[model samples]
Target: MRVHIATDHAGLDLSRYLVEELVAAGYDLVDHGPAEYDALDDYPAFCISAARAVREDREAGLDSLGIVLGGSGNGEQIAANKVRGIRAALAWNLDTARLARQHNDAQVAAVGGRQHPREEALEIVKAFLAEPFSGEERHARRIGQVAEYEATGTVAGRLEELRPREFPAAREA
Candidate 1:
């Protein structure tokens, strides 16, 4: 599987560590920069590029996933989710990481470096990589609900195409 990772200054060190780990694990990796650290560098640009690469490649039927890291991962995930077809999940622990992949079929994982120790972060990432989507009926149904929301800006179990009518209920009465 191919993995792409991107981050700004806050995550630079962790990102570099992950690169070495992933490369050693024999997975193809794409590392989006700050090739050299810049304190003022922004996260969204790098995160967006990496996240977009994964979505586009996956849409083209390439087996790929992405990682966006930051001081807290909140901004990175939010930016990644802005790209249509990218389900980015923030992973704080092994269970959450696994569930993000198993239940949501997320293609991008957001990691918060400042929130967890290096070992714990690595474990969470490992869990994310190891888990597969369950594809069970319930999981599929829930994912479908999210997909509908993504595509239509609404969700299932909500009123559809509500039309305002003055006293329309009078006819029914």
Candidate 2:
């Protein structure tokens, strides 16, 4: 997989560490970077660039993902998700990381550099990279709803269409 990564000054060291570690693990990496630590730098440009690369690469039929890091990861996640088709998730642990991919099929993961130790953060990223989305019908349907809403600004009659005709009876087998 091609991994595109970016971070602001707050996450510079962790970003460097992740690049080195992920590269050594045989994954192709693209660093959309600040290049040097600048305290006044903004996260939106870097995070959005990485997210856009992931979107473009995937659209071009390449397997790609993105990582955006910052002190708390909140702003970075928000920035990445601003891209129309990108699903960015804030993942703080192994389960959250894995579920981000499995449940949401998120293309971008936002990690808080200050939230975990470097090794732990690495583990979280690894979990995210390894989990495949569970392509269950409900999951696909929900993702479709989100995509539809994103493109059309409304889900319209989707809820009505998907509603169960009647609740299952409360009977014991």
Candidate 3:
């Protein structure tokens, strides 16, 4: 599988480590990176690039995924999700990592560099990479709803029907 990775200065070391480790593990890797630490570097540019790569690769029928990292990973996750057709999940533990893939079929995972030790973070990434989407009917239905809403501005069912209409003008007091 192809894995794209990106991060700001906060996660530079971790990102580099992951790149080397993942490459050694035989995964095709793309590093959309700062290339050097800069305290003022922004996460959005790199994370969005990585996310876009994943989306484009998938659209081309390639098996690909992404990882965005930062000090807390919160901003990185938000940035990645801004890309169309990208489902980015913040994973702090092994279970969350696994579930992000198994349940949501997320294309990108966000990890916090300052939140855990390097080994634990590596384990979390491993779990994320190893788990496969369950492909259950319920999960597929839910993912489809999200994808539909993303493509269009609306979703089906009650939410669509309940869209608020403009209120009639009230009589002047």
Candidate 4:
């Protein structure tokens, strides 16, 4: 898999570490940078760039994913998600990282630089890259709902399925 990564000044060291380690692990890595750390740099530009690259590559039939890093990863996740077709998930642990790809089929993962040590972060990224989407019926159905909402701003088909199910306890009340 080709991994595209980008980060702000706050995540510069972690980004570099990830790039090196991921490369050593035989993954094709692209670093969309801040080649040098600049305290005033913003995360949106880099994060969005990485996200867009992933989207484009996927559209072109290439297997690619993105990593956006920042101090808290919240802003970076928001930025990456702004790309129309990109699903960016904030992965704080191994489970979240794996679930992002497995359940959501997320193409981008946002990692908080200050939240975890470099080694732990690397493990999270590895788990994210290694996991494949489960492609189960329910997960695909849920993901389709999100994609439909994203594209048309409306949900169609099976309104009854979307309706909230009443609880038996409420009926008893």
Rank list by lDDT: 4, 2, 3, 1
Model 3 TM-score, all chains together: 0.91
Candidate 4 is scored at a TM of 0.91
Candidate 1 lDDT, 76-171, residue by residue in tens: 999999888889999988899999999899999999978887778778888898788888889888788788988988885564756677763456
Off by over 4 Å in 2: 158-173
Where does candidate 1 stray beyond 4 Å?
156-173
TM-score of 2: 0.91
RMSD of 1: 6.1
| Candidate achieving higher lDDT, 1 or 2 | 2
TM-score for all models, in order of appearance: 0.87, 0.91, 0.91, 0.91
lDDT of 3 by residue, 1-173 (tens): 99999999999999999998989989999999989999999999999999999999999999999999999999999999999989999999999999999999999999999998888988999899889999999999999989898998768774657857799999999
Worst lDDT 10-window in candidate 1: 164-173
Worst 10 residues of 3 by lDDT: 156-165
Residue 44 lDDT (model 3): 98
The deviation in Å at residue 13 for candidate 1 is 0.2
Query: CA lDDT of each candidate?
Result: 0.88, 0.95, 0.94, 0.95
In angstroms, the error of model 3 at 74 is 0.7
When 1 and 4 are scored with lDDT, the better candidate is 4
